[model samples]
Target: MGNARTFILMAVMTALLMGLGAMAGGSQGAILALMVAGAGNIWAWWNSDKMVLRQQGAVELSRANAPDLFDLTAALAQRAGLPMPRLYLLETDQPNAFATGRDPQNAAVAVTRGLVAAMSRDELAGVIAHELAHIRHRDTLMMTVTATMAGAIAMLGNMMMFTGGRDNRGGALGGILAMILAPLAAGLVQMAISRAREYEADRLAAEITGQPQALASALARIAQMAGRTVNIPAEKNPASAAMFIINPLHALRMDALFSTHPPTEERINRLMAMRA
Candidate 1:
């Protein structure tokens, strides 16, 4: 059901792009914008893991340092039927984690120092399994495409203002519409894809580990602490904020408006329900 919703939402986004492009640029322009967006996302798909890791100041986790973490992650990956992705650690006080890479083969999971210190063995296991589910589901690629498309749609809306569109009247109208609607579309896109994917990951993680309560507990603790701590890298690169398990930049007012992830309280409620 989640996959179906995502597919329909993606189709809607593409159609919106084409329709908006036609109004502003012409049929050809819409196609070009989509092609460009696709190309850009393809590149992002290839290099996202490295770019994200570096942007967040993640370093490779050595087995020598966190042997238990390595073992737990390896076990979860096995259960998820995915390769043992490379592990990285971020030196932040915020209890958060994110998974990257286009597919299971190239994936990596980075956990913050705060997350390591905050969660217990079972809580950490639940968190790791959640990330492993993301890797297995190839959510990194799906989210990359959705985010890039949203930016492209927003950009196209702005483009109408400068280009006056191919037809002056049509361009004017398109520009007005894009300006009003582009951000709306972007918000919807993130909610439809990113938020749904998070729910799906939570469900799959529960299935993989058979311990929804642990993840629910981890989430509750993270939510309590995330607002208190500042994640500097997330603040700097706000667009990358959606990659984390929770909205790392929870304090940002704009995030409250656009909200990349689903509500933590609701997520916990669902997870807790699974235990009954």
Candidate 2:
């Protein structure tokens, strides 16, 4: 169901881009839009993981440096029948973790220092299992594709801002509107897709861990810390906010339209339901 929904949303986004193109130009314009969006998606597919890791200032860690963390993920990967993904550690004190890479074999999972210090063995396992579930399901790949479309939309909006409405029919007025509004709309769409995927990951995590309550508790803790603590890099690069276990943005009010994660309470409730 999550994969199906992903495809549907991607299709809708593609159609919207074409519509914007048509509005901006014509059939030729639509083709141009599709090409640009395609290229952006391809670029994101290969580079987004690296880009996000860099944004978080995560450092690749060896098993020697993080034996327990490595051992835990290795154990979980074996249980999940997945390749042992590379591990990374973030210096932040906000208890959070995220997964990246295009596929399970290529995946990397990063946990923050605070996370290791904060969660118990079971809770940490639950959290790591959740990220591995994302890897197993290829959520990173899907999100990269989604981000590409969103980035294309933002690029289109930028183009509109420059041409002074000369090339497109909207002329100066339409250009102004597209420039002002399209990126914001694209952001909302991206956020909606991200939120949906979070819910799906929560369900998948519960299945992987067989301990829904553990994940539920972890989510509560992460959410509480996310509010008070600042992930400086995430604040600098809001586009990568969806990559974290929590949104990681301290302000928390990036407009509902732009929110990438669902309300924490709802996510916890859904995870707890699996316990029942």
Top-scoring candidate (TM-score): 2
TM-score attained by model 2: 0.89
What do the candidate models score in CA lDDT, each in turn?
A: 0.82, 0.80
Off by over 4 Å in 2: 1-3, 252-254
lDDT of 2: 0.80
Residue range with the least summed lDDT across 10 consecutive positions in model 1: 1-10
- Runs in model 1 deviating more than 4 A are 1-10, 161-164, 167-177, 251-257
* Candidate 1 structure, TM-score to reference: 0.86
Per-residue lDDT of candidate 2, residues 1-276 (tens digit): 557756776777787787678776778878988887777767877887888788789999888988888998899899888999989999888889999888887899999998999998888988898888888878887776776776677677667766644354677777778766776776667776778778887887788778999989998998887788887777787666777888787653546546778988999999888899
lDDT winner: 1
Q: What is the C-alpha local distance difference test score of candidate 1?
A: 0.82
